[model samples]
Target: MTTIDTREAAVAGLALFPPSLRISALESKNFRDEVGLSVDAVIQLDEIGVAFRRSTLFKNIRALLSENVASAEIIDRNNQSWNIALDKEKHGIRITAAERTYLIPDFSCLHPNVDNRLAWFDAETKRHGVSDEDLRAWRRILADREIDDEEVDGLLKQFRLTPRYVSAAIEKSLRRKNIRIDALIPDEVTYFDRLVGKPAPEHDLKQFFEHTTKERPGLDLPAAFLLSSHSFGPQSIALEAVDPAKVLEFFDWAEHAGDRFTQVGVVECGLRHLHKMPQLAPHLRNIIQTIRSDDLTSETGRLELLCALIMLVDGELARTGICRERQPFWRRLAAIAHASVIERAIVAVNMLPDDFIAWCRQSRGLHFYLQTFVDMRREPRWSPDLLSASQLKAEFIGRIVAAAPENAGTMLGDGSLELFDRASSSSLVAQVSFPFSFLPGPLEGGQPSIATMPQEIEDNLNEMLRSETLTAKSFVTLVNSALLYPLDGEFARLAAEGLARAKYELPNIKSSDEAFHLLVGLAIVASVTRSAKLANEVKILMRAVRRKPDIEISQENAFRICLLAAPASAGLSDWGKYIGDCATELSFEDMSRDSITTLWNFIEVLRQLEPTLLQTTSRADAALQAAFACCPPEVKTAEAS
Candidate 1:
């Protein structure tokens, strides 16, 4: 009906059509016109893949062209109508519009091979002014099925022209479905044929693991190990009950598995799980024993066994709802830490790298061992006599001191110096008080002998004093002749010097409380060494007791020492003075309830020791009256007096 410029007509025609139809029509335009058809005939061609004879195709094509609403016509160079042709035998179509003639082959002929027919159609659609994206959509249509008209209409509603857009969208949807369905098509025969050949690839474990990982990422290391070890199904709970032998086989496989760190992690995980199995303990123990005995013959085996032992002793395990009887883990540990065995364990520990050493040190069991070793010196020996017990304790302590890792001698006499230094640098003080050891039986004079302990007593004492941690009570205990055996004059002098140095080292001791307490204890020892005035100096230092000083313990301690140091020469007269001092310092207002009780006890001991003091100054009489009043009623009046 009308003629338009070639380029203008093509652009105008695309604009007249919906976007989806424009693209499809542009691709099939040459094919349609080659068979002398209008645009509607090309639209129908885009939907179905069926081919017809050229004569019949042309006749149908002309009917659609004659109804052209755009009123466009084919033209030549002279602006006249052009001839079109169709060769249905070859499925070839030729079109003449304006001065140009376009040849269009059937879609089947366009692709060189049937296998790539879709790809060729996609390429041609793109070349004929269809956008790259629309061409892909068209391919999807041809490839898919089960696409419905509603979905096509929904796609068309997004545009202005509904009718022209729906067909191509439906075709694209079908193509997509076809492609997917094709991929889903099974090769059952091929799969069975593969299985029929031989056994499967170790249950295809490696591939299955890879597939699982690719499908679901972020598995924990140990869990991944378990997964790779067995054909665990998709159900995690069900898979959890996998055969132990299969799991162990996976572990065995991992033993010689590649040198990947993952392999090691997996094997270690399996071993740890094995350790936790209650039923497997005996078996595992046997294996460990075997390894311990013979594994050392090979370096690698030894290392592995060592590593396994470390894990065995330390691993935290999950339970399978089973209860087990406890073993004597502590006794075993004691045997391990024994002098003979300890050296080997220590040497083994040292041979390991520093990180391993740190790990061992951090181990709960190993840390506990270190603490026990430090404390072993103080453990009491079963003594028949208090004196013998003391002797044995000292001897044991001496051996421990000898074991000190060098530099232990410096602070042994009085740990106060090191204590002061440590306190200045650190926030907390570590003080250990070792109990006294006395001979089991009394001497002819009923006095306990302090000397028979093992040589290790002094050595261990020195070791404790030399510790970076201070022993405040121990230092005072050793100094207090009232509390402990009086050291010889020479020993007393050395101790006094050591205490003096500690005072100087620990500047934090601003009050005479500590210094005076220490001095009083020192004086008591001096009195034991035959010096009375030193005991009196202790009295002067304690004058603060009357004023309710914070150093009441020091005062009480000083008084106790005075009683201990009072010359067997002072006899009863000395007791008068001691009783007077005790009366002055042990007032209820001046001391705590416990301290007052302790004061009463001291008077009792003094009364027991020197009954004549009661007669000389009536000190014993006064003490007895006080004890009778406060003592718990147990028919002990005779015992009191």
Candidate 2:
């Protein structure tokens, strides 16, 4: 055979070394003579692995070497040479007259002791010819506990085994010790990248996870590892291969056996991978249900779970696109964002750390905040801590203002005013007496009394009415001044007409501030003038405000507006019933002084308007009695009257 032919055979034979094996081993003249090939020929194959050696083409080259024939001649007569090919699989080593080629030696054929097996691994790893097959053989030999785990780890690191073999080693280690799989593998990008692609590593990962789950059951390590691997490490394709049923089973186990934090982490992982496995979409409700059912122990955990649920819903909405609101899932999500859940969420938002709050902001957690504000305002027993609920409302509105400052006026006016009107009216009447102080005394015919506006205020109102450049802010200020002093019939008509002009010019006044003012202005004018047109305008503006998220308007001005507007806007029939329902539903023992006072104001207003309209159930009466006990002597005396 020609030198080229002999060199080709040598190159093919040497292309099987693992990274731990030194290439310099082929440099020895004695080794070269023994192998019957040039060092250059062996150097060419250093990067190739044993899989290349097992190919049929490589086997044909081997047959040529065995026959002492040139590679060209063997290729020319492919059929005859293929038929003459030896079974290269029988042994990892082959010896011929021209060369001795080591493929992947069987270390088990030698002594089975720890020292001997380790020695074999060390020697093979140092030579220029170790292959992945050799690493596998070493793994099998070490699986018998012949070597210590430290030795296995050391060998794994020293030999630089491929991820597949490393995974095998990891699986074996897991079988012996409850150690993290990540601890066994190198934290190198290349190692993880290779691990992601290989089916053998994938299989080993699956087995290790299954073993860990079966043995430890509720340990978060497996879930954590999966999250890390799927999110930041080499995105494990094996995660997609994980059975949907298995994932569901894990969810079940996690729900019952895991802590709040672990359960949140599991759900987060599921959400992160939901796009890849849409089968998980249906189970999201159950996941949220699990979270909702959890004890209100860890505020941080509760916030985190809520954030995860928001992300899930956001993703679902984005995935489903424009028609999402019409779907059942949309309705379900709406239900999930219910008042009780929002109440807990509000508490969490109030108490959680700023970093978590920042995350919520970044993740659009304000959606939940808005939902809560809208839903809770309509509930009778809105919040146990009315003070906190009030603060949360301010915070929510503040965030909305901060997020879209330019649109604040229009958004708030159109969306928040009416909602705020209800709460503010309740709060204003319940807690303060100034708004109701305008009423005639109980001995003086029990009627609301109106007072003339001061000349200074009337002139300012006239100036505002005449000014063409009047803004919503200016309109609000003028109306507020008028309401504070009490509007006489003539001034109230002029103020109502001015409000009409402001509404016409500032048609886009959707701000909460503006809406609050406009609503009160309209109600005041409607009551003072007793005009159907002005009352209808109040209703129209109210309907517009109600179209947005709910807010409560509770201040002196709102009370004046409600008291003035109720008669002309129709009657306190609806308002009275709502207040009665709230009184019945309220847990007076849990209410604050301000909240109890607000409920009392609601009852007082109802009693003044149409006593029969305020239907009192026994529960409501008891609630009112309890509320009276918490009040000052003056309040109890007033209630007696």
Candidate 3:
């Protein structure tokens, strides 16, 4: 059993480090003499081994050899016996008379064979085994044989520089043979024996200081420094406890660091406590404003700054003590910064036309910003300005949409439509228009040709929708607006005709497929419009289209169009025929699996608006249940779990 030191045990917990860990600090002379002489022998063995053993070097090696050195006794500096024999068979070293042998690569050398020797020593030694500090010392000597070994030599001075010590020493003894080993050792071996340490990166003086946190009275601060005017307090009072020196130090590190990752770390550390320092709000505001567009685009810097901003704004609003008026300024600053990050990312996507689809497909770090924006807008202090967020989101979406059609190279992914749901649901466009009009920039009333100028507003909106960014409510609004456009008919036909002809490859052509879907959705809206001339005609056409079988279409597609035409507000009776067809298809175990899910969502939509539909789609519901039963137990469990 090993005895553990109270202090070391406290730091190490249950795990105890070996005694060798403190070898460098050990002041014992026996350890020093034995270790130094052994190290010298190893160095000699590295040189002319055969010649040294046969001549004067043999005598020097013998002078330092103790009875235990050549014996099986394995005791460390503590005088505890560690019964382990050195293996001369391993490395071609011979020990005469004593059965105990010394391995050429023993504790004194930096060699792989040392692991076994250390293990043996550890198993046999009592009290505790050698600590890492002792091993480190041995390694250092082995790493560079030329190092002036204090531990081993210091052992000799205290124990007496006797014939045993002198003879045991691998280097020649000046007193006995009047020979200097340094002169005898080759220059090549000496040069190669020196150790080279790893170089350190440049560090600044500002990093030297460390702050200690302690509770202070009356100031409401969590802590204070003995020599400083500044103190630590809650984040909302950040401005009051401002430490210009610490903040400046952080800024200096961020500005000077070559790696963006390091700079971002510094930026985060600097602003992490901002939520606790409301007094420092002005400085925090300045920092946010000073952050460049390039830095926001940087992989490292953006997330850090975003986290800091979120904490700052959210913390301030959460506190009941803060001034209500100050909330809007923080909210607006967060909003503008959030918007700017997305705007820059979208701009970057636009610049790459040929790779636009792939570019947009990549993660643009928008979710974090959008999430922060959503959370901030949810706070009671700023909820009334929900219009501000809606408008910001709308303008961003509109700009993206308007630009898409014009930029031939830039295309959207299937997922691009999703962003539209988010934007429209937030009513970002209307909100944005409250401050700035939704209309495109123009000189007077003359409208610019959509052909020449990029319609980024529309393009970005489409991109979001195709990406599935838009919610159902927002999608409905977009479809409704598109139908009201005088050119809705032409646009719908153009999109449908493109899909019909398979004008572009599905994977290569991104924007067109979504455009086709939007057009189809718009056509549905157009047919439902209650206008003077087309209302009756549109109803007649819907009925006619339902009954007529255009040979160009499949039964599957016809049913899908019917379901598409079925509004969320449509009653169960209205969707009975379409739901029946969907159930029948699902029953046949057809390849159109996705159609079943689509029908389910549509049915769900109607169920919410028309409860009667839930009763009407009984067969559809049963078939869905059966299909789900046919799935594997794991799948069922996954769904249930």
lDDT of each: 0.35, 0.40, 0.32
**lDDT string, candidate 1, 384-487, tens digits:** 12222233223222222222223322322233233223344420112111443221111111122345434555555455445454434545544533334434
Candidate 3 overall lDDT versus native: 0.32
**TM-score list, all predictions:** 0.22, 0.21, 0.22
Q: Can you write out model 2's per-residue Cα lDDT over 403-491, one digit (the tens) per residue? A: 22232222333232322232465321122233333322111111123456668767776776567665555555444553345455555
Stretches of model 2 off by over 4 angstroms after superposition = 1-452, 498-510, 528-531, 545-564, 569-641
Worst 10 residues of 1 by lDDT: 316-325
2 or 3: which has the higher TM-score?
Answer: 3
What residue runs in model 1 are displaced by over 4 Å at the alpha carbon?
1-392, 395-520, 544-558, 568-572, 583-598, 616-641
lDDT of 3 by residue, 1-641 (tens): 99866545434532354566544323444644544422232224333232222223323233223223453432233333333334545633333323533344333221234454344334322212122333445444434442233343332232222212222231233223322322211112111111000111231111111111221212211111111111111112232354666655444433432122223222233344444433333432333223222333333343333333233323222222122232333323322222222222223233213332222213222222222222222121121122222322333333333322321111222232332233465322223332233432211011211333236535644553344222322344345343223223333343333333332222321343343354345334433331212222222333333333331333334333333343321233544444444445544443344555554544444343334546666666677566655653443335555
TM-score between candidate 3 and the true structure: 0.22
lDDT of 3 at 43: 22
For model 3, the superposed segments whose C-alpha errors exceed 4 Å read 1-520, 527-565, 568-589, 592-612, 631-641
Supply candidate 1's per-residue lDDT for 292. Answer: 21
